[model samples]
Target: MSCAEESGRIMVGQEAPDFEADAFVKGGFKKIKLSDYRGKWVVLCFYPGDFTFV
Candidate 1:
């Protein structure tokens, strides 16, 4: 990376690294490939384990 880019932390607007990873959906296991949402914004979220403080 160039000095300017390195000096500053990667910004949100930049494209995320290409990747394919697992995820939990509707209490079921599933694979969530990032490429599926190419050119679109994706908001990932998660909840804590049961009994944990909200």
Candidate 2:
């Protein structure tokens, strides 16, 4: 998607939205709750695809 299509995206200094995801960590169950990091700054990130070269 182009920038305009994703223009609704927010950046730094603004309050982050609540998000949650289930993930496996150290071969055990893990729950990531965005709300848990409310007062902290987070580096939210991802790769479009892990094995593909950009």
TM-score of 2: 0.56
Model 2 over residues 1-54: C-alpha lDDT tens digits?
111122346777765666678767898988787778867867877769768885
- List where candidate 1 sits over 4 angstroms from the true fold: 1-9, 45-54
Query: Quick one: best lDDT, which candidate?
Result: 2
Q: Estimate each model's TM-score.
A: 0.48, 0.56
lDDT, each prediction:
0.62, 0.67
Candidate 1 per-residue lDDT over residues 1-54, each given as its tens digit: 112122335468775555566666899988777667977878865577878875
